[model samples]
Target: MDSIQMFLANCNLSVSQAMRKIDSNSHGILFLVDDNNLLVGCVTDGDIRRYLLSGGGMSDVVARASNQKPKVARSLAEAIKLYHNRDYVVIPIINNQGIVIDMYMGEGVKDKKYSPLHLPVVINAGGKGTRLDPFTRVLPKPLIPVGDLPIIELIMQEYQSYSCDEFHIIVNYKRELMKAYFADNEANYNITWYDEEKPLGTGGGLSLLRGKLKSTFFFANCDALLTANYESMLKFHKDNGNVITMICAYKNINIPYGVVEMGENGVITDMKEKPLISFLTNTGIYIVEPEVIDDIGDEEAIGFPDIIEREKQKGKKVAVFPVSENDWMDMGQLPELEKMRKKLFGE
Candidate 1:
């Protein structure tokens, strides 16, 4: 595809299609145009996410999630000036008729760097990845390759970009292999190892660091990688006075075929064809306070979700931060692993 086509999408395109375009373009934006090739709006990953969070469906048209009035340049000189002045990664040059004639990409747009977060990150890497099957039989899921680096390393790097340097990894299944891989790597990462003697569910492993984390820290699953804004999530957690802030993704599942709703006496009351259902699902990432560690009992086989529920029961502040479906990468299953690899490395 040509450069211009890569970032252009018809207004009638589905939200999912527009998401794919934004992901592949690497500019994190898409120009929505009408049938006449006139610019109608601008769509970004954040725009789609907000649409989904607000009950928008994946099959909804791109126009429903796009900015009706986007910042634009009228000419090449104006585009260049706007690009540097606003530090924009990409800007569309439009004519008097609002038709996009060209685009300007800022220098080093592809190599943008994020500010450091300097927060501690805790990764739960102790689970036996039964879903991945044969692959997990040899190497632990965390060590499984996602592009050039292991899944665990990629998860760590996501945090490192936010300047989160200190890592606390909880390991159990094939623990040595996980440690050896990190030890052999040239990239120096500061990590603290916590060994789980037996199979402990997600929240159980956290009990080991009851006193280690004096301040707020990030907790993530080894099989998941999220590209959402960590700073914003942290701010939300603190601002809300939440003890645990879970990160969730607004996922839309489109069910195929028509469904009939039966009433009394098997009477068909309603029928809808290929309806789309939206849900806010846990993305296995969190910003947690240190005191919550006391709520978990050592060696207890309880998942993190259950822990959150218990905290809620006690009236402790617990909240959820939602991200777009495209921001989350689930590497738990073989199919998802391949999908994540392709998404991250264009494999």
Candidate 2:
């Protein structure tokens, strides 16, 4: 029996899907998928690198590697040698007719836990934050004190909990101060800086970061806060290969008075009192692919929603991941910040 069959119970992925797993992992050589407890196909590092070199997009299927024969090993030493020479991280022990009996993974597989890849988060912190009133007169929105810690740090900590450390923070106003703050209190993480000489509209600031960032990185309005599991979200993004993914929260509004729905013939067909309406408002968070950022115009203040519309015109894949109403928090307004403080630390 091969190790691939064992992983079938663990990963719950098809052979075709398992093969692509090597792309994200550096040490892994190949991934194995099973079909009804039977060996199906294998994926190798070479297969993924070739696909990228060919300019094959993320949406392109990696089904080609499924036809190749997997390297077999009888003992652990033989498997280790095969893994080292061929650079295959996982070797499946199989019998005739491609039946997976057992599987083996490289070292650290037992120690390191698996974290899901969903979306990379990019936080835009460049704005002057005129909406924040007196706070903007002194500190940047990211630097504003939420409770005991700065708001940006809290935001980063939230994403960090999900093992997302790849961050890109757009800086314009007080760029020096922001950089200094981060440098002084360095958190062992990777954060690429995007500086704007002049004010660039929310969408325009991202134009400079097109190629420097990952193919898909989430964009968040610095001042906004929300509670959600990033691991699950990124898994959804990869599974769908979405070009743009929005994290939305539902907002409910109550009508104070009765409302009537009238027909064209001046007849009131329906009447409801104090109706509670629900809407999926933008939560100021987005998971955007690199190709989408390429369309951003240079040195202008363009909004991301406009870019989304453009992608839609071109028939690109744009999606939304919704969160519960209580799980989301907006710090745009002063009162909202107070409410968030209480929610975060309790009154």
Candidate 3:
């Protein structure tokens, strides 16, 4: 399919198909058209999310989640003007017949630059990755290759795009190999090495950098990759007076069988077949203040979630920043790693 066709979805297409099109397209938008190739509506990732939140299922038609009245240019001149206005990255030009004839994609739209964040990133890469089995027996989880780059490098590069260059990595299992891999590589990432003599649970590793990180930093697990907007997340974190902002993903799970709702006396109140359920799941990424490190004791093996709960119990501001399920990829296990590789490299 051509580049433009990838962004075009039929109005009768399933929500799942529209979602795939949106994910594969350069722009986060899908243009919905009718059987006669007439413009019907526009669907974005946000629209699908809101639809899911409103109990819309994946089998529903794309039209139900799309904007019936969308901003479109009637002529080439108008499309150019709209594109130049910086209000949109791409403008669809429809003829009088209501058919999309062409599109005006602004220059650098696909390669848009983001402002630098200039924040330190703390990555917990010390896990033995027992779930990966024999592979973990040879290599650490962070050293596992997602594509050409290892998972740790990929994580660092993602943050580097937002100009977050400094990285503080905590390593324990296969620590020497992790350190040696970075030492031999030519990628000039600003890295500070922290060693754990023994395994420390996720949050416990942060204790090694008690005096290192004096400012706010990005904390992430080496096994997960999140494509959410870091700048927006940071803004929300600071605006809400949060001590730690956990990034969570809204996961939608579809049940295959009919679920009968039972009330008092075993009376069936309602029945819905293959209902789609949405839940907010932790993505293992967080924006943390330096002060939180004080709560973690040295050589302690506490998980990160435990720390968050403790802070909440103490009445500290702990917030959650939500992202779509598609934005977060957990690569801790074999199946998930393969899925993440295909998603990242389109294999």
Candidate 4:
């Protein structure tokens, strides 16, 4: 249980202060306290937005833009239940004196029991590595060494950090090699094999295990290394009623030449020189509901994105969360793989 001092606002705080408090606390809420260290009211992003949208001034007192009585819970289960009920980012816990004693965050809860976090993950390890060429000719891309460890082993370790143990590796090209390597290593993760006799596209192999999984799980391409809080991602997926949640990364594309935005009559609305363009690109990581397995076609080449888009057309909620740029490492090409080796091994 952690809390902020109520009477510490000797100086005026900005909206950015509130945002920082919310983020640091992981609850998406901040409390406005009085001189006696008593809770005056609580401020949320929505509350601030409402005041701003209603033409309220930024210099107004925080108490004027807060909720009088915020929803709260005493125990962990009740807190989780409240988190599932409302879209609140944080819940404040106050004692009889109306002073905030604790704060419960919605994004940092780990499953105490094995049930929620132990979903069956699918690893798409079937891609033909033409990019790495000669090196991949002898080794499957999944088994390619990132440092002293295989690429897929590092990926599994990342998921294991978040308590995910059950894994399903989809194998096609050099399936026996992957199995033999895993058999040689005395690893402890529970991995089930899904062997494709013929070459199936990345998403097509997942259909082979359609009936094998029964809980919300994750899927990833074996080549990309991403570091993210999987528990927070899963909670976001379930709390928002989303059937599928794709993890995206902010990628910047540099323009060598000057860029300009022109209007209909060729008038330059805005002009800039070699500005960097940023966009969210898929990191090939996803959390998907179990029922989506029923949507997998019986064809040999159906892809996961195509099936997800079809579900979206049928009104299923699909969400996306962004990750940091430095956190995503793709070992698909020789140059990138070399960079990863240097970063991992400090060579």
Candidate 5:
């Protein structure tokens, strides 16, 4: 099979099977073809998401979720024109028979337009980072190098892409190094540094700015880099009137090999060759309102999840914004450092 073949899916395939094709393409799109290899429809990344959110099952045929009418070009000239003139990132070139022959995937397209959010960002950089002990012994985890730039810098740059510049960083362990590193950097970031007098947990340090923040803000861990759109997250928070919106990603766990389920007396009940299970996990990034700060007791040590749970118990609106698994880069573990580097630089 050729490179473009990865982007083609059978119309009869299950939604999960089509999802695997979409993942392989890495462009969040699939061209659906019938048995005769003629394009029947298209499924973009958002299509499956909508299908799932609308109570559609993953085991159903993808034909049920695909757009029956998809944009296609019958000639090279038409394909180029469509690629440049519209927001569509990928366009399929098809012959008179509607068989896909070529593709215009990248380049010559307009840059992604992002509206200014102007939200404040708070980074919790205070932990001792015992997870990365040896490295944390040498340098703060926030300063740990993912590539040429430090992890903290990468986190800030992603937010900067959405026009969020104001930052509040809470620091404790090796704080002087964290402050000095940013102070001497030429980027000249506008930052307000908060010191934890004692070891305050993730949500505890946020209390330092209890009365200062007047609007919604972005809160994140220093080690997590999210490539998803920040503007969409903010819109969801405000549109749903949620006091807190936790950004999460679906993690797909694939179990290979035939597995059997047994009943009493070890009788075989059922079996499957392989299974793919997906679970949504927190990415440690959040859209938060200022009022949440006042809810935290000053200098109390509590993880952010616990704090959010407390607010939920009080009947506050806390929602979740889901993104795909590949959108998040976690630098907390030692093994993930190289993975994150390769992801950002494609080394």
Candidate 6:
């Protein structure tokens, strides 16, 4: 931020105002101060999201969504220790008088993006990439360039950050080219390649590895990348006893016109100007148990969502792990490829 003021907000600000400030600060958080400039509480974009999801409106006062007991430091030295010990992005340094003095951004966790999760990952790269059209005619979707590296490589490197080095890639269209590119590359990826003789839709390829994966593994689509904390996701899946945990992203979309809701006979019960709709969209990423792979029926065409539904119907513990909207990136389309390029490489 240009100044520390961007991270500081008056405790009386509205939720929408705090949301905008947090967006501008790019830290997803803000420290709120009272009239006397005393630290009152802290609010984060996540707090606002939970509020909205729980039927709270954006026009509500931010204090209603604030965490009353926020973690703060008395000195920079203490802030640095707290910053590393806890994964806090920003910590406010306050005086004994309970007045806001300074803010500290520490150093340690900045260099290390992720800890070791040590899980195996399965990448579904079998699609024909028809959406990409002419480009798909030559190079496969997995080999499509996002920045300097292919999208699949970027996806793999993301998993590698958590020490999940083992990869199982299911390839169909242009399988030979996909294999050839990795065969000569020196990234030294421990990859097991699976071939689908007939085009099996998203989840069908798992049938090929029915007996292979013995433990928990990540299942991902090559066209999208997820930046959520892998360790936390794994813990949630295990603690919840979920056989499949589909990673979802909170997507916020704004309506251009006034949204109206009618109760009966042209009687408008509720109306809002330019309403923002929130949805938990699937990010095409999953943490799956061995049972899920074994449950794959046949060499039939089936999307992953259908598989999840089938498991849900069978009373299997299927769950969802949600991340912020910015954490997921999809490069399935030509237009989104540019967005992905800028997000990954700042081009």
lDDT tens per residue, model 6, 191-255 = 99999999889899999888888899999999999876788788879988999999887666778
Q: What are the models' TM-scores?
A: 0.86, 0.64, 0.83, 0.66, 0.93, 0.86
lDDT of 4 at 255: 86
lDDT of 4 by residue, 1-347 (tens): 32454212312455434534444454345677677766666776456545654665444565666776767666657777887787655565667776667666666664432224776689989878889898889999999998899999999987876678889998888889999999888886689998877767767787788788888889898999876556667777898898889887655556898988999999889987976565567888888887777777664676667767978998999977655455578889999999888866888
lDDT of 1 by residue, 1-347 (tens): 38999989899999877877787786789999899998889898878867865788777898999999988998889988998887677888888888888888865536656777788999999999999999999999899999889999999888988989999999999999988988988987898999999988988999989889998999999999998778878887898899999999867677998988999999999999987666688999999999989988877889999999999999999987877677899999999999999988995
Number of clashing pairs per prediction, in order: 5, 16, 0, 2, 0, 0
Winner on lDDT (2 vs 6): 6
RMSD of each: 3.1, 12.7, 4.0, 9.1, 2.0, 3.3
In candidate 5, position 45 carries an lDDT of 58
Quick one: how many clashes does candidate 2 have?
A: 16
TM-score top scorer: 5
- Candidate 2 per-residue C-alpha lDDT over 1-347 given as tens digits, one digit per residue, 9 for 90 to 100: 34343244212433224433442343445534444545555554345434533554333355543335667766667777786676455777665655555555666554333364534667889888887889888888889888898888888877776677788888989888888888888575577888888887777888878778665777888987777656656666778888888877645566898999999999999999976565567888887788877787777688878878888899988877755455578888789999989988988
Candidate 3 clashing pairs, residues 3+ apart or interchain: none
For each candidate, the alpha-carbon lDDT, in order, equals 0.88, 0.68, 0.87, 0.73, 0.88, 0.86
Q: What is the TM-score (0 to 1) of candidate 3?
A: 0.83
Span of ten consecutive residues with least summed lDDT in model 3: 106-115
Q: Rank the candidates by TM-score, best first.
A: 5, 6, 1, 3, 4, 2
Q: What is the lDDT of residue 63 in candidate 3?
A: 97
Q: How much is 112 displaced in model 6, in angstroms?
A: 2.2
Positional deviation of 247 in candidate 5, in angstroms? Answer: 1.0
What C-alpha lDDT does candidate 2 achieve relative to the native structure?
0.68
Q: Please give, for residues 1-347, the per-residue lDDT of candidate 5 as tens digits.
A: 48669888889998777877787677788999999999999997578766876777767899999999999988878888997788776788888888999888756545667889999999999998889989999899999998799999999988888899999999999999999999899999989999998988888999999888999999999989998778877887899999999998767767887889999999999988887766678999999999999899989899999999999999999988877777888988988888999988988
